[model samples]
Target: MHNPSSTQVKIVTADPSAIGLFGLAIVTLVASSQKLGLTDGLSLVIPWAIFLGAFAQLFACIHDAKHNNTFGMTAFGAYAFFWFATATSWMVKMGVFGSELAGAVDGKQLGFAFAGYLVFTLFMTIGAMETHKVLFFIFVLIDLLFIGLTFDAFGAPEAFHKLAAFAELGIALLSLYGCGAAVLNTHFGKVFLPVGRPFGIFKARS
Candidate 1:
């Protein structure tokens, strides 16, 4: 008689947050430039929106799923899709899909979408509180950005547009810092950059 022996194998994966943040940083930086009137036209912005914003975050989302990180996966996935949809909307407005579709464009429809994202981001901002101060503030900026976008879409004053532009620029700067922290901290095997500790308010029971 022989006794059976079992061996367990665990797969290790790198954290995808750095790349995800990098993607977010790049896209927001470029988009904010346009929103701030520093740049013109969506022609160049669409490619970056699709490639960096959509695909890169989507790549992070997949790896985060493999890591069983629900928060990272959901956050990256939702933002990835948001970029994808935004890109498509830009294309449609640009008449890439044909004149008829572009002619039917309604700013109010986009307003509704922005409003919905605002609602989604509010909950996500709450969730980010347990992550880190850097991430929490990033979410806060994103919330402000969406608020401005939602109001601007609905024909709000120019101030709201400026609000969105500045908020988006803030997001870009913070995300760049977060990306650097994620990479350097991991590479150095130490806290090379401090992202601040989580608030510890809503931690799940072990």
Candidate 2:
């Protein structure tokens, strides 16, 4: 039997969350190390930002879209672009785009970008409550990260930078755990690692 109405009804794809979370973990871990004064220079960080932070998440977002995972797709896609944009901004600041353009860059503008992401992450955090504890924790840390980044960009106290650094580190740790959970759970054909249940606060209204 052939159906012209649709090419294929069943769409199969591996869960992309593991790789997505791994990419996020790698980027944040490296970035936080710099912010924590344990490392220096973003020249080394740029490649990770582009490959792991941007490309890996973008790949996850694409597969997520194929799976019809609206929330996952949008979240991964947004953050994927966020990494790409931030990487480009770093290049500009480093004078890769010429001295004049680099000189014209403003830190406050990055504050605006961070603030916008804070708002976006807030709503997504609510959605994550229904996903799993690991993901929910990740969102919470993301909220904190955005908060710190926004305030730090706007010239807030050094404490804000510290806050962001710690938050980013937390994101990395939780994301690594999430990545492992996603992989092991699916591969073992059982819950090898538990992510915990949803909050159930938003169960469908009957």
Candidate 3:
């Protein structure tokens, strides 16, 4: 007679940053086109915002959580919800919810919301500095985007909105690069694309 024993194996998870960055890239690219006056309608932008911006990042957030990456989880989750909220806001603005809801809209509330996200992105920018150059620049552009968005929300100037439009475009470009780097580097098992090293500013000495 023999006794049976069972063994446990840990499952490996793939990095979610590539897909997340791709989502960010597509949505921002589309939305920035509208803000830059290259597009005429939010109707065309809504689906991408909901699917690529909100859903994709939200999916990355779940995987990041599984990987025990606190920063990644928080960043992806926050931006995912931000996109969701923005899509809903656009719907309200377009009177999709109802005329009464659209009529009751308070633009200042958007100001407050953008201001809050600006604050959130600032801290996240610091964290991104530790990741890689591509990601760092992406977050830096994100910070600028939020800054411009915040000011524009509060009626600062058209310049601020323009700044946000450009910054958002920058984010889309950088995110696409990041997505490529993540995929190619992992697939090749080498630094096929240089993302640069993390800054030594914050780590403690050994």
Candidate 4:
């Protein structure tokens, strides 16, 4: 019989949130490319949804699971599933699935979806803030993304589309930063963030 205390468990010292950050970055950049007409909308959006949104977040969730980080795991895993579902929804809308339900899901229905996502994002954002600065930035970007998505869903018109694009760009930039920070900190095996600085304001109270 193996003694659990004596068993050498290799702790995962690296932050998994980097995956989500980088994933959001890629998603936003590709979305911007589509909005700018640099690429066909469907062509770029599909890859963004699948690779960036789905797989990237899924990778983070897997790492969190390995670390036994319930909060991180739940946050990343839920979003990963959300991305997968939304990706399928996009494919269905593009007529790839041949489902009549896709046709019936207009902008308003999509708006409701965004609203639901925004609620989820809030919960995840709270969790993110408890993690680190890199994660905190990602949460902020997620909040912006949800806001933009909700607005677009409600038929806010073309100007709001630009706002969404900019928000996405912000998400990408912050994601890249978060990714860099995670990689650097992991390699160094040191606490790089300043001591006594709480990622969440509420956490400082405790």
Q: Local distance difference test, per candidate?
A: 0.96, 0.95, 0.93, 0.73
Put down candidate 4 lDDT per residue, 1-206, tens digits, no spaces.
98666667676455777777688678777876776567775755877778887788889888888888888777767777777777787787877877686677687777887788889878877876666666666667767777777888798877766666777777777777767767767777775643233455667634
Better of 2 and 4 by lDDT: 2
Q: After aligning candidate 2 to the native by TM-score, how far in Å is the CA of 162 from where it should be? A: 0.4
Off by over 4 Å in 3: 1-6, 204-206
Clash pairs of candidate 4? none
Write out the backbone clash pairs for model 3: none
Better of 1 and 4 by TM-score: 1
Q: Which stretches of candidate 4 lie over 4 Å from their true place?
A: 1-14, 36-38, 99-102, 190-196, 204-206
Model 1 per-residue lDDT tens digits across residues 1-206? 99999999999999999999999999999999999999999999999999999999999999999999999999999999999999999999999999999999999999999999999999999999988899999999999999999999999999999999999999999999999999999999999999988888889522
The lDDT leader among the candidates is: 1
- Count steric clashes of candidate 3: 0
- Evaluated at residue 185, the lDDT of candidate 3 is 99
lDDT string, candidate 2, 1-206, tens digits: 98678565775789999999999999999999999999999999999999999999999999999999999999999999999999999999999999999999999999999999999999999999999989999999999999999999999999999999999999999999999999999999999989988888997422
Model 1 clashing residue pairs (backbone): none
Evaluated at residue 62, the lDDT of candidate 4 is 89
Instruction: For each candidate in turn, give its C-alpha RMSD to the true structure in angstroms.
Output: 1.7, 2.6, 2.0, 3.7
